[model samples]
Target: MEYDYHCTVCRGHLRIGNKLVFSAKTRDNKYGLIFLSPELGDYTTEHHPDFDIQEGEEYLFYCPICHARLNHTENEKLVRIFMVDEKGAEYEIFFSGIAGEKCTYRMRDKEKEELGPDSEKYRQYFDLPDEYRKYL
Candidate 1:
């Protein structure tokens, strides 16, 4: 089933064809377009050769449409986006911003699901009580 990804700020459609496109910026100020697989847990990515993404390095993500930064304020290492399934169920999707780290989370209300091997890296942040969420 196909799911729609949207920008959390501008609510712009992010999925084009089979990829979710985003504007990415490296720590060195290098910029490029990043195309990511729509499937959760899939780490496949496509980008310009000149815009090298270093593994284990955190990068910034932005909405291609509104230029809104996708980083979650609660966790700089996590990028946030909105998702709607074919049945119109909405979810908050969070994924690792560090290159080569496979971590993705799907959350709706009190229900939460984690995907990818590296998900445990930040799983505790989401699982924490609301009082301690700011610590991450």
Candidate 2:
């Protein structure tokens, strides 16, 4: 099944087909959608000469179409991303990733009974696998 991500604020596409299919590098020197992976994981990023992050800097991931910030706020770890499952159900995913550390991810879902109308389905991450959970 294929899942997709869109910017809730601007309705912009962020991901498609296991890639960062959309891209944006603004005049303000900001880059778009960074999908950080494990040390040896196979992932793709645009190698633009003007796009470079110095040592000890947080990566910036903005929407390619609207340039809205995804992934995080300045100095904030938690990131809220908008996603759609294969069935076309929308969800708001919240997670955290620290700079220079291996990324972490979990898959789980639950009832939205208590949430208000504006809230879509919320899935709290299930316990990660032993290898991933051990380090947390």
TM-score against truth, every candidate: 0.97, 0.50
Question: Which regions of candidate 2 deviate over 4 angstroms?
Answer: 21-46, 54-56, 71-75, 95-99, 104-136
RMSD of 2: 10.5
Clashes of each: 0, 0
Best by TM-score: 1
lDDT of 2 by residue, 1-136 (tens): 5667777578666665566443433345676435432211222244446556343354545566776666544323434556677898877644432233333332235422222231222212223333443233
Q: Per-residue alpha-carbon lDDT of model 1 for 1-136, expressed as tens digits?
A: 7999999999999999999999999878989999999999899999989888899989999999999999998888999999999999999999999999999999999799999999899988998998899976
**Which number leads on lDDT?**
1
**What is the Cα-based lDDT of residue 68 in candidate 1?**
95
